[model samples]
Target chain A: MVELLAQTGLNAVYAASYISLVAVGLVLIFGVMGVVNFAHGELFMAGAYAVVALYADMHVPFFVAVAIGMAFVGLLGLLMEWALFRPLKDNPLGGLVASIGFLMILQSLAVMGFGVRMEHIPPVTQEVVRFTDKVGLPVARLYVIVAAVVFLSALWYFLKRTRFGWALRASAQDPEAAALQGISITQTARIAMFIGAALAGVAGALTAPLVSVNPHMGHSVIVTAFIVIIVGGVGSLEGAILASIAYAFVHTFVTTFWDGVLADIVGLSLMLIVLIVKPTGLFGSADRA
Target chain B: MRNFLILLVGLAALIALPHGLSFSQQEILVFLVINVLLVTSYRLLTLTGEWSLGHVVIMGVGAYSSALYTKELGVYVPVSMLLGAVTAALLAVLLSFPLFRMKGFYFLIGSFAAGEIIRLIWKRFREPFGGVRGISGIDPMPDFSVGFYQFDFFEPVSYYYFAGAIVIACLWILWRIEKSPVGLTFHAVHWQDKLAQASGVNLRAYRTLAFAIASGFAGLAGALQGHYVGTVNPNSFDIEVMVFVLTWAIVGGTATFYGPILGCIVLTVLNEIVLREMGLEQARPLIYGAIMILSILFLPNGLESLVQKATRRKTTAKPEEKAAT
Candidate 1:
């Protein structure tokens, strides 16, 4: 019984890794740009598709394909900003509406480029660290765990210690103030968009092998991301990461114990309960709320 | 008298539209009416500066509630529809307590989460909502004999008219609400909630009331849709549908009362005409996305603003020309 709980804990941690990557990016973009990029999940999808196109099809090295996928999707984010967001800067609703439109375009493009069928990618590693007969961790998943830790730690350091990172944080905390302090809102927005998109891309690329890759797969990810953001408070990055871990544990455990359908229900119910008790979320300050 | 005449003419045109078009076109019109009703309900909450993205889920609640009641309890269609709307409204009221405390983007996310919770409930409760496969063979509205004529809602034209009437009724109520003192207060709250509250407006009550009214209308639209479509699926109320409704409202212009109506009509027409011609299944969304982006960049107020601008330009030009002449 103890072993089973330990195994579930391990699984929860794995889920938390990728989920935080996606949620943190989502929160960062929202914090800086003040626009919810509804097409965010599609960017994640684009990353996975990059892997399918490069490594699965062309036989590129797995890590190289993942790198290429992250960069490519990050560029897509830059394009979105230039084409849609920058033009609609004054109107948050306009930016949001445009993102929704972009989401549809991406989904359709994916469908056109890759048929509706789920693309199968060969496993990057078959090696698993067995703790017991029924408990083991796949090396591929371990890569995700390690990548999340390193990237997130690096992100923390950059935000706390680096110059550009302070600029990013300052812009997010108060754009007008940051602008007055000589921080370029435009530059900060671009940086935020790129890093945010890249985070989502890396998460998608890393998890592509674990999940079914399809045109519409972004639908669920975006939904889950939204739930996490809401539970974390809309603008708090720390809240997003923490809430992602909490949500992932609850959802994954429920799925393992009961069913996927019920797990979704319980997950949403948890969101509602949190909202009812604390509308600003656990980490969201009243001012931010 | 002029306004009454316009209304009569509008009603007459709507009544005659189905007869002038093919069955498929009538089906499209029915769907358009559904979109119109849903969009109007969405606008109701937005009037108070509270945008509810999960409104499609309220519609889903209505759809599923009525669907299940009729399918399982064997309830009469009218009763089932009423129950559905009530349930959805109740849920909205229940959720508003928690949701209303959050402002702006937080509120939006809260409502969105609530909607997802509702969808999750439907998906989980297989016995009630039919799970993933969804509830099929929903009994259509039965025939009714009124003195000398029998009316059946099963026909596409009849369903269109029925749906259109509900839509018109909803629009009328919304129009009345928009013109009411409460509506003025809602606008005031939307523009500046702090000021409105300072001036003795109970912001919480008004916001909650707005959400309830909107959710109620969404439920009505959903119920009508279930009867019209004769099927209820959990997928119908997903985020994608919410995006479409939001797009319609945004494209039409959120500033005017008639924006959603115009948006629904234009998008529905474009979707029918252009989506059919493209042969590329994904082209419609791509084009839709392009249009939304361009519209947002160029016409922040929406397509209605364009018309308003054009009319104003003409009126201004006429005065200048008269002076010159």
Candidate 2:
């Protein structure tokens, strides 16, 4: 029983890592741009397809493929900003609607390029860290945990310590005021888009080996990400990360103990309960609420 | 008189459409009506500046509820539909108390969460909603006799007419709301909530009322769809459907009541034609994405705006030409 709980805990952590990566990026984009990029999960999907195209198909180095995937998808994000959001800057709704369209385009492109079938990604690692006779942690999942910690810490350091980071946060907090402080809103937006896209890309690249990869896979991820961000509060990065962890744990546990369908129900119920009790989310400010 | 004639013509076309189309074509038309109903109801909610990304879930509530009640409890279809709509409205009202406190994007996300919660509940209760597979074999609307006419709703044409009538009725209600004082309050809230509040307007009440009304209409659409489709799956109410409905509204013009209707017709036809003719399954998303991008960039107000602009230009051009001459 203890071992089972330990295993489930490990699974929960793994789920938390990916969910946080996706959710934090979403929050960052929403914070800086004031436009919810509905195509974000598709960016993640594009990243997985990048791996499928490179490492799985061409026998490229796995790490190199992941890096390329992240950069490539980040570049796509930059292109989207340049092509869509930049022009629609005056209308947030316009940007959002455009992003939804871009999402469909990406999905179709994937289908055309890779067909509708799920692409199989070979496991990166077969080893496991044993805690007991019946309990163990898969090394692949451990990689996700380590990557999340390192990436999140790096993000925190950048946001808290770096010059560009302050500019980004300042712009997010108040664009006009940030500009008064000599911050370039355009540059900050570019940076936010890149980082946000890269985070989603990295999450997808890392998780590709574990989950079934297909064109429609982003649909679920995007929904889950939305739930996390909402439960976390819209513009709060800290809220997104924390809520992602909480949502992931609850969802994973429910799925393990009960059923996948029920797990979704419980996950949503948790969001409703949160909304009813704390409209501002766990870490969100009242002003934002 | 002109507007009345236009509406009468539209109603005539709607009533006669199913008879002109084949059975499969009639099915598509029914789907269009459902889409139109859902999208218009969505617009009704958006009037208060509360954009919900989870409307498909509200529709799902109605679909699942009606499907379950009729299939499981042996309830009459109309009664089940009413129950579903009321239940959805009640849920919307209950959720609105907390949700209305939040502004802009926060309200959007809150409503999204509410929709997901309802969807989850339906999915979790397998005995009630049939879980993931959803409720199937929903009984069609029964045949009934009025004084001089027999209506068999199971027939495609009959179903289309039934759905069309509901659409017309809902549209009438929406039109009335849009022209009423409540509609002004809704617009006031959307444009400037603070000002609306300062002027003694209960912003929360108006917003909540709009949401409840929209959800109720969504439920009605869902019930109709459930009976028509003969199945109600959890998957049908997922985010993709919400996005699709949203796309319809955006492409058509969210500012006008008829925008979604136009969008539904254009996109649905495009979807059918493109998917069938090109065999470019993958290209469909790309096409949709391109359309959305172009629409946002060039036609932010939607196709309706273009028509309005063109007509205004034509009207103004005649005076300029006469003066120049």
State the displacement of the C-alpha of residue B157, model 1, in Å, after optimal TM-score superposition: 1.0
In candidate 2, what are the lDDT values of residues A1-289, reduced to their tens digit? 7777888888999999998998898888888988888899999899899999998999898889989999999998899888988899999678888888888888988988898999998888899999888888889888888888999899999999999999999999899999999998999999999999999999898888888999989977887898898788778988998898888888888888888867876776677666667766778883332
Task: Write candidate 2's Cα lDDT for B134-163 as tens digits.
Answer: 888898888887767567876777777777
Q: With candidate 2 superimposed using the best TM-score fit, by how many Å does residue A267's alpha carbon deviate from the native?
A: 3.1
Off by over 4 Å in 1: A286-289, B1-5, B145-150, B314-325
Best by DockQ: 1
Q: Which regions of candidate 2 are displaced past 4 Å?
A: A231-233, A286-289, B1-12, B145-150, B314-325
Global lDDT of each candidate: 0.85, 0.84
Candidate 2 backbone collisions, by pair: A101-B289, A104-B285, A105-B285, A105-B286
Model 1 residue pairs with clashes: none
lDDT of 1 by residue, B162-249 (tens): 6776778888998899899989988888888889899999999998888898999899899989987888887888887888888888
**The candidate that achieves the highest TM-score relative to the unseen native structure:** 1
Give the alpha carbon lDDT tens digit for every residue of A1-289 in model 1: 8878778888889999988888888888888888889999999999999999998999999999999999998898899888888888877677888888888889889988898899999999999999999888989999899989988888888888999999999988888999999999989889889888998999999899998999999988887888898788778888988999998899888888888878877777777777777776788873343
